[model samples]
Target chain A: AQTVTQSQPEMSVQEAETVTLSCTYDTSESDYYLFWYKQPPSRQMILVIRQEAYKQQNATENRFSVNFQKAAKSFSLKISDSQLGDAAMYFCALVVGGSRLTFGEGTQLTVNP
Target chain B: SAVISQKPSRDICQRGTSLTIQCQVDSQVTMMFWYRQQPGQSLTLIATANQGSEATYESGFVIDKFPISRPNLTFSTLTVSNMSPEDSSIYLCSVEAGGGETQYFGPGTRLLVL
Candidate 1:
């Protein structure tokens, strides 16, 4: 079974600063995908970024980037220039082709202004 | 991008009653998933609904307790039967988009059983 683990339960970042949330997974499959989802108070889960296992380069979307280390099974989300709107619960998820997605415990991010 | 909408965004149902939540997607999708998010907890997969087939439930979930229906490629419904306090959680519907692994989630339906 594939499992995702998020070590940080809570994190805070000052406005205009950056914060990184750690995530690790256990998967034997050589091909997979990683994603970061942000759930705001509205309870709408939004896709933050995505990374493909075969890609060596990290994925970047605006201020959101992922440091994906496939060998170590580590996929961390980096939020740069944090803004107040970034406050939410962030979840790391893993997906194998045509299979259900496994999600991390999630990290509650607070943007301190 | 696919846009999804869930009916009865939030509801307060009494125990022993069943509440059916509807999920509608703007575009057809091959895979649709239902998830439950307990208070202060991460999302847990309840079942996977595919068109023209019975829903595949995950471990610890069953059809009697949470019956699901996928009538078409772009519509599905999940019913919480015999609701209890434990069933009071946010139920979400998600669909695969762009033929990639990424999933787009709908605005969840919050159920509060009393």
Candidate 2:
């Protein structure tokens, strides 16, 4: 069984600043995928970014990037130039091949204006 | 990326009642999944709604309690039967697009069992 863990229960960042949310996973499979999802007050789940385990280069999407360390099984999300809209509950998820995803407890991000 | 929509954005039902939530995807997809998110909890996979086949449920979920139907490639429904206050939660439908690993999610249906 694969498990995702998000250590930070809550995080706060000022507008235009940067913040990083830590996530770790335990899996025996060598090929898998990691994802970061954001759920706002609207209750809409949005994909922030994703990283493939086989890829050495980390994935970056605009202001969001991930530090994926496969050996340590660590995948952290970094939000730069944070905006108020970024405030939400962020979740880290892991999935292998076409299987279902395993999600972490989540980190509540608060963007202070 | 695919656009997904769910019916009855929200509903309030009495205990022991059943509610059916619909999910529609704009594009054809091969994989569709249902997830449950309890208040302040992480999302948990309830089942995988496979077209033309029975849904595969995860551990802790049963077909009698959470029935799912996938009539076609882009449509699916989940019925929560004999609802109780503990059943109150947000249900979301997701689809795996052409990409094998990435999943697109619906807005989610909020159910409150009184």
Candidate 3:
């Protein structure tokens, strides 16, 4: 069985600052994928970024980036130059091949101005 | 990512009433899925719908409870039958648009069974 854990329940960061959300998982599969999704109050889930296990390079999309440590089984999301729009519930998910996705409890982020 | 939309964004229905949520995508997609997200919880896969075939349901979910319909590649629907308070949750339909392992989601239908 695979499990994803997000130790931080809530996180806050000043506007234009940086914030890192921690995520860890336990999976036996060597080849897998990690993803970060964001859901705002509107209840729409948006894909933030994704990292492939085989690739050592981290995935970055403008302000969003991921630090994927395959050895430690850790995939953390870093939001640089955070803005108010970045405030939302972030979820860390792991998937192997085309199987079901195991998601974490989620971390609620607040961007303070 | 494909443009997706769901009907009846939010609904409050009486107990024992069934609600059907529709999911429509802008382009033809090969794989479509339905997920349920309870209050303060993560999303769980309910079933996977493919064109011209029966939907594959996940464990803990049954076809009787969540009857799914996938008539084509661009649209799907999920019906929550014999609803109860426990069934009240946000139902979202996602599509494997970009292919690979990524899935894009709909806005989700918020159901509150009274």
Candidate 4:
């Protein structure tokens, strides 16, 4: 069994600033994938970024990035130059091979202008 | 990213009734899945919609409760039968593109069983 944990239930960041959402998981599989998904007020889940466990380098997608520490079982998402659109519920997920995904509780991000 | 859409964006149904949510993708996909997201909770996979075969349900979920239909590669549906207040949640469908590990999701159907 796999479990994902998001310690922070809510997070706030000033406009144009940065915010980091913490996530940790427990999995015995050595090869797996980590993902960050965003669900806005529209209730549509969107993929923010993804990181492969085998790769040591972090995954960066424009304003979003991930710090994947395999040894610590930590995968945190960092949003840089945050805007109002970045305000949403972010989820951290883990998937091994072609299996189903296990998701975290989610962190609700609020960007203040 | 694949574009996905779900019908009946939100519905309020009476207890003991049923609701069917439709999921459609823009292109042909290899794998389709249904998930449930309760209020203030994370997403839990309900079943894997396999084309030309019965859906593979997850533990604690049965086909009798969540009857799934996958007639093709780009479309699927999930019906919630004998609904109750406990079944009030958002139902989302996702698809994996061409055997890819990543999955894209639909907008989700919000069901309020009253």
For model 3, residues A1-113, the per-residue Cα lDDT tens digits are 89999999999999999999999999999999899999999989999998889999999999999999999999999999999999999999988987878899999999999
Instruction: Tell me the tens digit of each residue's lDDT in model 1 across A46-84.
Output: 999999999999999999999999999999999999999
TM-score of every prediction relative to native: 0.99, 0.98, 0.97, 0.97
- Candidate 4 segments exceeding 4 Å error: B98-100
**List of chain B TM-scores, one per candidate:** 0.98, 0.97, 0.98, 0.97
lDDT of 2 by residue, B4-55 (tens): 9999899999999999999999998878999999999999999998898999
lDDT of model 3, residue B12: 98
Residue-level error in angstroms, candidate 1, position B30: 1.1
Of 1 and 3, the candidate ahead on TM-score is 1
Q: How would you class the docking of model 3?
A: high
Candidates arranged by DockQ, highest first: 1, 3, 2, 4
Best by lDDT: 1
i-RMSD per candidate, Å:
0.7, 0.9, 0.9, 1.0
Best-fitting candidate, scored by DockQ: 1
Ranking of all candidate structures by their TM-score, best first:
1, 2, 3, 4
lDDT of 3 at B87: 94
- Taken over the whole model, the C-alpha lDDT of each candidate is 0.96, 0.95, 0.94, 0.94
